[model samples]
Every structure is written in structure tokens, then in C-alpha cells.
Target: MALNRYYYPTKYESRAKVISLGVKCVFISHQQNDKDAARKIADYLINAGVDVYFDEYDGDLRISHQSNNARAVTDSIRKGINNSSHMLVLVSPNTLRSTWVPFEIGYGYDKTDLSVLCLKGIPKGSLPEYIRTANIIRDIYDFNIKISNVLEKSQSLLEETKLMSSYANSANPLSNVMDAMINDPYN
Candidate 1:
């Protein structure tokens, strides 16, 4: 499938701010049977300047060399989730039956700052219970929007954090004294 690179308004101040932020890395979770779809999503994200972490693309050689132990695989997945800013779970009919996807989703939700998104690979009303709580993307168009939104929101949060840190570190003895007085009970 041909995927077009998405462009946001570069002239707008808010868009510019989002653009200036570092690349948003995404960890993709998919069943081994859904590699083709996962690759397409990875390509789209890469073309849009987003970093993608997919085990099929990056971990196959390593896994083959290793003992293929369940603990080893889970550890690697945990590391990927921890390093990524977002997680995209491709939910195909086959994926529903896979054991690893649910574990990846739970690990991502409990262990990291990653925003989890579920992308539908087939027309199905029922989704796995683990992904029901996540933001769902129904098609390629929705996928583009969800990925863009995640990056923009993450950048905004990062900017806000930086601003708050700067303000906190600024020399403000009067504010400190006021805080000290307000909290002091022996005044």
C-alpha cells in the first residue's frame, strides 16, 4: 500500500513548537502473522519522521541468536516499551488469539509513559479486553491522525514540563519566603 507522508502547518507557532521537539519513538505490538501490516504502519510513521520500534524489523536476528526463552523476550519487550514514548498495538483477527500482545499492552500501561493506541486490522466489533481502554484507530487515516495527535500532545507536555522546571529554578526568594510562612505552624 502507498502511504503518503503527513504534513502539519509549519508556519503556525504551535505547530512550529511541536516540530522543534525531538522525534517521538513508538513501539509497535503485533502478532507474527501481521508483520506486513506492522511494516506498513512502521513505514508510514518513519516517512512522517517518527521513530518506530518493531521487533520483527529489529529483533528477529537477536532472537534467533538467543535461546528464545520467554523471559528473554519479555525483557526485551519491556525495554522497548520503556524506551518508547508511545505504543501502537495492531489488532488483527489473528492478533486477538496471540498471547504476547496483551502482555505487551499491560506492560506498556503499567511500566512506562507510553500512550497506548489500538489499530484495527480487521472489521470486528469485539476487541481484546486489554485494548478496550486504549485509543482505537480504525483505518490508515485514523492511524495518521492518532500518531500525529500523540506526538503533538507529547511535545506539548514536554514543553510545559521544561517551562515549569525553569520557573521552579528561577531565583524567587520572596515566593520561597511566602511558601515558608504559609506552611509554618509556629508563626
Candidate 2:
């Protein structure tokens, strides 16, 4: 694989953003409809000092994959997943309708540390069955603990962020949409 202008560039090449840290880069998998919630989760990971490959922020991923080229989309996604050590699937009711979410999960199934993070307003048995076996991030508290376990010094950072969520005028650095517990349908 030589770098040449002839090859179609993926997001990593187009953005020129390099992640030197070799540890835990997370590939966030969510349906397009759940973008806002996924962004919040990505933000929390970013705040925790984790490198994330959330497609929304990458213009190259958006531009290259929207041309209806199956190869382009699959390549872009594969690259993102391969570059990551973890995959956090932000599961919501919208996810059930997503074609790509299932693909992402399956492709990264054996490679990345996968976790399914629930959103609000979901029921206990509503989550797709395939994802139930993965580690479930039950709530914000569970998220905090999981992150802390993954990275040293994250506990304090999360505690500080959680405190920030308490301010009435301030938007939660973690999540503005859900409080301590998300809308977990499967408990």
C-alpha cells in the first residue's frame, strides 16, 4: 500500500489528523438519526482523553461515503474500525432500523472492545438481541466507571465533568439529554 494520489482518500488521509497514542481509540457506532446522542458520547470520550473516530466530525468520511459507492463506504468504515481499539455502540430505538450499525458491530466484533450504551425512552426488551451479550453501559454512572477502568486518572476527570452537569445554566459536559440513568429498555 503506497501513498499515491490515484487512490481515493479516506477520512484519516484527508483530515491529516494523526493519533500517535497507540492505546484506546474508540470507533463510535450509531445510526444517523441518533447523531446528537452519539456526539455527546464522543465528547465525553474526548474529554476523557480517548481518541475517537466519530464520523460526524470528519468531513472526509461524510464526503467520501455519500456518493453511493459501496466500496467507499465500506472501506471508510473498515479503516475507522481497524484504527480503533474499542467500539461503543450508542444503542437507541433508532438503531433497530439502521443497516450500517449491524454491519459495524459485526465487522468489529472480534477486533474491538465493544460496549452498548443505552439511550433514554427505551424499554427493557426493546434492544436488538445481537448486542445484548456485549458489556452494557447502563447509565452515566456505568459510563464513568467503565472509562475510569479503561484509563488511569479518568475517575477524577469524570467526577469533575459530572459536577459540571449539576450547574443549571451550564450544559452537561457528559450529556445534556439524559440524567444519571438513560432510557434503558433492557435492565
Local accuracy of candidate 1 as per-residue lDDT tens digits, 2-98: 1211122121223223235543567788888877767766665665556666776445336743766777777667656655657787776777788
Question: What Cα-based lDDT does every candidate model obtain?
Answer: 0.53, 0.70
Query: Candidate 2, which segments miss by more than 4 Å at Cα?
Result: 1-22, 157-171, 182-187
TM-score of 1: 0.61
Q: Candidate 1 regions off by >4 Å? A: 1-23, 64-66, 111-121, 153-187
Measured by TM-score, the strongest candidate is 2
Tens-place lDDT digits, model 2, residues 78-116: 888776777889888789899899999999898788998
